[model samples]
Target: MSDEIAVPPRQDNQQWLRWIQAQYGGPACIRRGKRLHDALAQLEQSLARFRQPGHDDDWLAMVRIRLGQLHALAGDWSKLEPLLDADSLRIVQQLYTDLQPQLRLPPAPDPRPDVLRTALQELQEAIAFFNRRWLRHLQSLDLSFYERLIADYNRYYLLEKECLLQSPRLARLGFQPLPSLTWQSLLGRFPLLPMPRLRNETSEH
Candidate 1:
């Protein structure tokens, strides 16, 4: 029998999600550890073929995040722990510490400008630090990990900027106003935005 597996020419987020469900979902008794490993290897190959600089990183990030969730489901922390480098891990830990409260909130129809500004500043600082430390080694590291980091920062920046521009206090600050965004538009723009979902929560979903 051929060992080769056929994959789609262009893999999208939904495809990735489906692949994950097929591998990890269903009755617990039927789940196989080897299947999870094989699926992750296939995912890496797909990522190598499909990744496009500046565009596909977010997709890659979601795939990797899903892989981590699968590993946890398989009780294979050893596989997931090494997916990110030391610096990336540190940065992620810091981000969780700083952004956990805001991330846990339910969707807000009207968010405070001061709160948004604070979140924006934190993201800006995190992005600057990430770029300074990891920019040079980007290709060597898991692109998806970096993608997740960048996506999180950028999502907050966009969300906060939108809120701040609507503030009366900042009206005369002379910053050019971005076009107004609907809540759906804002959420759609950053589909990989970090959420409060735990690892088990993702696996179950």
Candidate 2:
């Protein structure tokens, strides 16, 4: 009745997690759920918001990537411009502008050990809070795009991956159907926030 994942005794077993993820989707059938990307594309296209035709462009996908960059402090956001149309770019710009005030940090204070430790602890807490809220919001996002991708995988992933085997039945061998990806399944792969360096957390003891 619940979507929360249950772990086996050997939780580190990748094969077990993959199998569980596969079985945890919608009832096995071809094309069970609607495609999110196509539906969004149709709506945006009707509004004439897209400049490039015939491209698999999903503005929300781009939005998520850029947002992740902002959170992770990893990539160059300006470089994202050419990948989007003018209107879509405008949306991204406004979003960044709005979030800037909340995300901006006052310059780091004294870099002494005590201050640094406190800062690290506070930053980690903030990330944990953001992680929960971010994941919940993400789960609420349209599943159509990812669902369709998984459905395609459900349909053809094995054949493509195992084509070298050269036997259709062998290609299909030992295959189990994977459902659309769920936040829970993603959680299964990575249950902890990665960056405060989980391993070193115990080193302090």
Best by lDDT: 2
Question: What does candidate 1 score on TM?
Answer: 0.19
- lDDT (Cα, tens digit) per residue for candidate 2, span 88-179: 44544554453332323434234344443443444445445545654674466565666676677677756654543457787677677766
Deviation in Å, model 2, residue 159 alpha carbon: 10
- The most accurate candidate by TM-score is 2
Q: Which ten residues in a row have the lowest lDDT in candidate 2?
A: 25-34
Candidate 1, residues 1-205, lDDT tens digits: the string is 9788756456675675466457557322123323444544664565444223235542233333332233223242232233334443444444444333222223332234344334333443434443333333333444453344334443454344345345545533543422432333323432222322222222221
Quote each prediction's TM-score: 0.19, 0.30
Residue pairs whose backbone atoms clash in candidate 1: none
List the candidate 2 regions with Cα displacement exceeding 4 Å: 1-114, 152-176, 188-205
Q: What is the C-alpha lDDT of each candidate?
A: 0.38, 0.46
Q: What lDDT score goes with residue 66 in model 2?
A: 33
